[model samples]
Target: MYVLDTNIISELIRPRPNGGVVQWVDTQPLSSLYTTAVTKAEIYYGLHILPMGKQRGDLEQALHQFFSAGLQNRILEFNSTSAMEFAMIASYRRKAGIPISNADAQIAAICSQHGFQLVTRNVSDFAECGIEVMNPFTE
Candidate 1:
């Protein structure tokens, strides 16, 4: 199974999304793709901060429909197992002087707990998180 990171989700909603990313997503079974609550929060936060306008309105509608239709049952939560994974992963990275944002760590934790590969554009951010990561934008 693959968990989509925020960047992948964001790209899918773009008016002219990357062809590579779109192609990659199209080849996967819908049931095999998932997103985390952390990604939801990130997407929502981005939409919330945008100034009210046609762009925002369009994106809001697109995301609403996408989540409701495409990912209703595929949204993963950061449960107890994820939290423990976060603590371990975050602490290890911190001690090693690696700077990973809390959100990325949380997403990584969810992926780790579920044994899911992460689909993201920001591959380096997740490099040492002990989860398989694929950059659909590039490969």
Candidate 2:
């Protein structure tokens, strides 16, 4: 299974998205892909912060398409297991001075807890978190 990061979701909605990401996603079954609650919240926060304009409109439209176009069922929530995983990862990172943000930790926790390979453009941020990560933007 694959868990999509926020940036990857943004790429999918772009008019000219990253070709590597597009191709990789196209070849995979939709059921194998998922978006975590962390990612969803980030996307929504981004859209909401944009000024009222065409850019915002476009982003909003793309976001709607993302949810409505058969990707809705894959949104993973922050359940008890996810929370426990988050606590563990967050505590470890803090003790190790890794300085990982809460959102990224939550996303990584969900992915790790579920044994999902994370798909993201920000590959380095998730390194050493004990989960497989694939950078679709890479060659």
Candidate 3:
């Protein structure tokens, strides 16, 4: 299984004219698509920057589409298991002297804990976390 990063989801949610790569990626089998609860938060927070009009409605509609898609998508909820995983990830980061956003760190930890490959546009940002990374853009 693979977890889709927020930026990739955003692109898929509202494909750009030049987003041929995103469009192509979206056509792939849904069996491989997944996203974390953090990604859900990212998408929701992103919508706040837009006007409270059609754009907000559009974003909500996109979210509905994601929920209806035939993927076994699950929110990577935080629990004792995830907390342990997060602590371990943070320890590693601390030892390595790496700085990462809390949300990014949580995403990396979830992927690592669940043995899921991370599909993202920002490979370099996650490289230090040592999780498997797939850039659909290059595929």
Candidate 2 achieves a global lDDT of: 0.89
C-alpha lDDT of all candidate models, in order = 0.94, 0.89, 0.77
Candidate 1 structure lDDT: 0.94
Q: What tens-digit string does per-residue lDDT give for candidate 3 at 20-127?
A: 556656676677677888888888888777788986887788777775563344666656786777787777887888767888888988898898899888997787
Quote the lDDT for 139 in model 1.
91
> Using lDDT as the measure, which candidate wins?
1
Worst 10 residues of 2 by lDDT: 65-74
> Model 3 segments beyond 4 Å from truth?
17-20, 23-28, 70-73
- Looking at candidate 3, the ten consecutive residues that score lowest on lDDT are 15-24
lDDT of 2 by residue, 27-98 (tens): 999999998988999999989988999999988987998887758789988889988998888888778888
lDDT order of candidates, best first? 1, 2, 3
Better of 1 and 3 by TM-score: 1
Candidate closest to the true structure, highest TM-score: 1
| Model 1 Cα shift for residue 125 (angstroms) | 0.3
Which regions of candidate 1 are displaced past 4 Å?
A: none
Better of 2 and 3 by TM-score: 2
- Relative to the true structure, candidate 2 reaches a TM of 0.94
